[model samples]
Target: MTPPVPPARLLVVDDDKGILPVIERVARALGFDVQFRDNGREAIDGLEELDPDVALVDLQMPGLNGLDVLRAMRDADPDCRVILMTGNPTIDTAVQAVQGGALDYLEKPFDFDRLRRLLAGVRDGIERREALLQADASVAQRVEFHGMIGRSPEMQQVFDAITRYAPHVRTVLVTGETGTGKELVAKALHAVGRRHARRFLTVNCSAVVETLFESELFGHVRGAFTGASDTKVGVFEHADGGTLFLDEVGELPLTLQPKLLRAVENGEVQRVGSLDTRKVDVSVIAATNRDLKADAGAGRFRSDLYYRLSIIEIHLPPLRDRREDIPYLTAAFVREFAARVGRPITGVTTAAELLLQRAPWPGNVRELRNVVERACILSDGRMLTDRDLASAMAISGQAAASAPPMLPFDEADDADPNLLSTVQRDQIQRVLLDTGGNKAKAARVLGVSRRSLYRWIERLHLEA
Candidate 1:
C-alpha cells in the first residue's frame, strides 16, 4: 500500500488586503497548505517557524520590503522558493528580485493562467525534492549493485565494465585506493560470472603469515611444516570450479609470486612438502592498492605475474575525483547509520551538507561512512545539524583543521573579555577572504546562512 503525499506548504505575505483573498483562493485551489502574513516584518520573523516550501511576497511594504524578507528566508531556509509580486512593478525591480533569489516576479492585475502555471511548476519542483528525499531513505538497502551505490559518470563506466567483463573474465585485476571498494568489484565479478553457483573464496595476502603463505594458497600434506598436525586444503582447492579473490595482492612476497603465477596460468597447484601437482579449475581475481606495474619495473614484483594480471584490469576512481557522488553517498550512509542506531535521522542540515561538500575526504568512502555513523550516533533529532556533525568530526581530529572553524562560545569569558571576539572575527574574516568575497561560499564554509553571514559582517565591521 502506498502512502498519500503531503501537500506543499505555501506562505503569502502582502500589505494589500485585496491581494490576500486571491492568493488564498489560488493557493487552496493548487492544493497548498497556505499561511497569510499582512506585513513583511511578520513574515520575516516567522520564516523559520513557517518553514514554507514556497513564499509569495509583496514588493513594497511597511517596515520591511519583499526583497529583505526573501534575503531573510534564503538565510534561514535556503531550500524555500520565493516569488515577489507588486502593484508598481518595473523591469529594474523584477531584475533585483530575481537577482536576490526570488523564483519569479509578478505584476498587479494578476494573470490567473500565468499564476496557475507558476504555482504548478513550484508544486512539481516540491514533489520532485520530496521524492528524492524519500529515495535517499531507501538507498542504503536498495543499491543497484552489490552494496555499491553510485550514479556518477565514473561509476557508470565501472558498472559498464563490470557488466561486460564479469560474464567472461577469469583472471581480473582490480586496482583502486584503499576504501574505494575493490573487493566489491571482485564479488560482483564472481556473482555475474559463470562460476556463480560455485564457492567464492577470499584470501588477504597482507593478513597471512609469511611462513604460512604457501600453505594458505595451496593445500599442505601432513607433516608439511611445524604446524602440520593434519593435512589441510588451501583456499585455491576449496574454490575449485569457482572464483578466488586475492586482496592486497601486491603484498604477496616476491619469492612466492612465481608459484602464484604458475597456479594462475595453469589450473594446477602443488601442495607444500609434495612433488605431486593437482589440477583445479579456479578463476582468480587479484586486488591491490599499490602500483604493481611500478613494482614490477623496480624489480620488487614479478613482471610476468604483473603482465598476466594486467590482461584484465579495472581501476576505481578516488572519492575526491568523484565529489558529485558525495551527496548520494552521504544520504546512503545516513540512512544506514540511522537504522543501525535506531534513530529517525532523515538527512543533514543545509549548512552541514555544505560543510561535507567543502571537506577534503582523504580516506575515501570508508571515511565518509565512519563520519556519518559517528554523526548519527551523536544526533538526537530527526535531522542531523551542523553542530552534531561538527562534534562527530571533531572526534576524528580532521574536521577541526579541514572543515570550517567553529566560532567562539556565545558567552564571553571573564578571563578574556575580547579574546573570544577577536578570534571569532579573525576566523570569519579569513574564511571570507579565502572564498574571495563569495558570501554564499563563505557562509557555507562558516556553516551559516547568507543572512547570518551578512549579520556577522556588519557586527564585526569586516569588509568583504
Candidate 2:
C-alpha cells in the first residue's frame, strides 16, 4: 500500500489579526499545516527552525517589512517559496518584492480563489520536486561503481578501460588531476585482477622521506643501517603476488628511478645492503596528478620508467569535466552521509542541486564529498537547501564569491548603497573586526569564500 504524504508547512506573517483566521482556514482545507506570525521580524527569526515550505508575508509591517523577511528566508531557508501580501500595492513595491525573491504578490481584500490556486501550485511544485529527488536517488544507487558514482561518457570510458585492462595488465599508470579518484581506480584494478586473493598495498611516494625511499620500496635486512635493529619487508615484498599502488609516483626521487625501473621490468628487488636480488611477482599500479610525460621530457622524471609504466594507462576525468555525473554523485553522497550521521535527509532541494551542478569543483570529487558531508552534518531538516550548501562551500573555501547577490538591487540604488549593500558591508566589517582582520576567518564567519571576501573588501572600500 502507498503511504500518505505529509501535509506541507505554510507560514503566514501579517500584523492584521483579522486576516490570519481566513488564511489558516483556507490553507488547512487544502492540506497545509499552518503557522502564524503577527509581524515580519518574528517570521524572519523563526524561519530556520520552522522550515516552512511556503511563506506568506505582508509587505507593510511595523518593523522588518516583507522584503526584509524575504531576504532572511533566502539566507536561512532558500527552498521556501514566498508570497508577498500588500494592502496598498504600488508598482515600485511590487517590483521590489519580486526582486527580493517573492514567488507571488497578493492584493488586499483577499481573493480567495487566487490564494487557493497559489497555495495549490506551491504544493504541487514541492511534490514534483520531491518525486524527482527520489528518482535521482534511485538512479544514483544503480550507477555507483566501486566507491565511485558516475554516468558521464568520460567516466563510462574510464570504467570500460578498467574492465578491459584489469585482468591482463601488470603495469598500469593512472593519470588525472588531484582528487580525481586515482586511488579508487588503482584499487579497482587490483580488485578485478587475477591476484584478487592476495594482499593489496599502497605507498604514497610523496609522503616518504628522501633517504627512506629505497628502504620503503624494497626490503631492508637487520643491521643494514645505523638504526636497522630489525628486518623490515618493504611494500614490494609484502605485496608480492598482488598489486602495489604507488600514489604521487611523479614525486619519486630521480636517483631511485633506475631501481624502480628494474623492479617493474624484471620483478626483481634487492634489499638494502644486500648483494643479491630476489625475484618477486607483483603488479605495479602508479598514479600521479603531474604530467609525467612532460616531466620526463624536462628531465624531472625518468623517460625509461615513464615509458614502462605507461604501457597501459588509465585516466580519470575531473568532476567539472564530467558534470553530468554531479546529480548522481550528490545523491549518493547524501545517502551515504545521511546514513552515517543518522539523519533523515533523503536528498537535497532542487535549488541546492542546481547550486552543486553549477559550482566549479576545483578539488574534484573529494571536494564535493567534503561539501556534502558538511551539509549533511549541519542540515536540520529532511532536505538540504541552497543556504546549507552555500555555507558548506564557504567553509570549505570553494565558494564562488564573485557571484551576484540573490536579491537584485535597482540601478539607481547602486550609487547610493542600498539597504542590502549597507547590511552586507556592516556585517563584513563587524566580522573582520571580530576576527582581527583575518580574511579566512572572516570568510568562514560570513559564509563566503576568501576570494569573495577580498572582492567585497575592495568593492566596499574597507581598510581590512
Candidate 3:
C-alpha cells in the first residue's frame, strides 16, 4: 500500500488569541500538525522544538518583532518556509519580508480565501520537500538468501529451479541482465549441490585478457609465455571434483570457446606448454548477461558450445519485473549495511520506502545494495530520511533532492472526468516515481487497490 505523506509542521506566532483560533482551524483543515505561540519570544523558543515547515508570524509582536524570529529561523534552518502577517501592512514591511525569505505577506483582517490559498501553497511546498527527502531515504528492512532477498514469484521460481537442478545438473547456464545476482545464484547452485564441501571457484571471462583465456582456464607451465613465470593450476584444474563459475561467459573469445567446450564435455584440460591432457571432474556453471543464443545465431558465439552450456538454463528476472520483492530486498539491504557501518538505523521513513519502491533499479539488486550501503554511511539519525538518501543518490546524477512540481488541483466544481483522470494520472506518476515504480506502493499512496491501479495503468498507459 502507498504510505501517507508526513503532516507538514506549522508554527503560528501571534499575541491575538482571536487570530490564533482562525489560523489553527485553517492549518488543521489543511492537514498540518501545528504548534502555537502567543508572542515572538515564545515563538523563538518553540523554533528549536517545532522545527516547522511553515511559520506564520505577526510582523509586530511583544518581546521580539516577527523579523527577529524570521532571522532566527533563517539562521537555524534556511529551508523553513515562512509567512509574515500584520495588521498594518506597509510597502517597506512587505519588501523587508520578501528579503527575509518570507513566502507571502498579509495585512489587517486576512482574506479567508487568500489565506486558504496561501496556506495551501505553503502546505504543497512542504509536501514537495518531504517527497524529495522521502525518495532519498535509504535504510530498509532485511530479508535475504546468501546475501540476497527476493520473494516475487519470478524470484521464487529461480530459487526453486536452483534447488531442483543443483544436485543433478552437470553444466547449468545462468542468464540475466547485469546486477541481477547471477553470481549469487551460481554460488547457491554450488552450495546446494552434492559438491557443497568441494572447492567452488569463479572465473570472470570478461576480466581476463584474451591471450590468457586458455592459460587461465587450463593452466600453463613455467616459460609457456612471456609472463608465465611458474607452473600453476588453472581454474578448471583447481576446481576438480567441485564447481567452476564462468561469469560473463558471453565475453569468452570465440577462439577459446572450442577449448572450453572440450574441457567441459570430456573433463580433460591440457597445459599451455605441455602435450599431456589431465582429466578433471568439475561442474561448469556459465553465466552471461548477453543472449548467447542470439549471439550464437549472429555468429559471435559458438552455437555448438552454447548448446552444451545451456543444457540446463536458469534465467533470473530483472528487478523491475519483480516489484513485489523490493521491500524485502530493501529491508535486507538496510540490515546488511547498518551492520557493516555500525549504524543503528532501523528502517526507512514511509516517504523513503515509497521512493525506493518506485526506482527503475537499472543496476538491479547490486545497485540497490550499493545505494543502501551509501545511505547507511551518510546517515546520522537512527532512522533513514529522504534527505540522507537524496544526498547520497545525487552523487550518481539522479535528481533526488528536488521534488517534481505537483499538478494543479484547483478546478471547477464540475470538472471533466477526463481532466480529473489526468490529474489522477499525474499524481500516480509522481507517486510511482517516488516509489521507484513499485505498483503496489503507488496504489497504496494513490488510495486505490492494486487491481484498480492496473486498470488505470492500462487506461492511462502508465510506464509503471
TM-score of every model versus the real structure: 0.58, 0.57, 0.56
Candidate RMSDs in Å, in order, are: 11.8, 16.2, 18.5
Candidate No. with top lDDT? 2
The per-model lDDT (C-alpha) reads 0.79, 0.81, 0.77
Tens digits of lDDT, candidate 3, 1-464 = 23343467888888887787787788899988888888887777656456577888889987899999888877656667788999998899899999988888988698888888988998787666555443432221212355556656687678778879999998999999989999999999999899999999999999999998899999999999898899978999999999999999999998999999999999989999989999999999999999999999999999999999999999998987776666566666777788888888776665666566666777888877777788888889876777777665665444442332332221111122222222355577788899776554565566654434554666556787
Candidate number of the best TM-score = 1
* Steric clash pairs (candidate 1): none
Candidate with better lDDT, 1 vs 3:
1
List runs of model 3 lying over 4 Å from the truth: 1-143, 227-229, 399-464
For model 2, which pairs clash? none
Q: Model 1 over residues 1-464: C-alpha lDDT tens digits?
A: 12344467899998887877787788889899998898988887666456577998888998789899989888766767898998998889899998999999988879878888889899988767655544543442222466686655677678778889988878999999998889989998898889999999999999989889999999799998987988989889999999999999999998889999998999889989888999988999999999999999999899999999989999999887776566667787887888899988877776676666667767778887888899999988887877887887777664533554333322111111111223455567888889777665676777754444554676556897
Global Cα lDDT for candidate 2? 0.81
Distance from true position, residue 422, model 3, in Å?
30
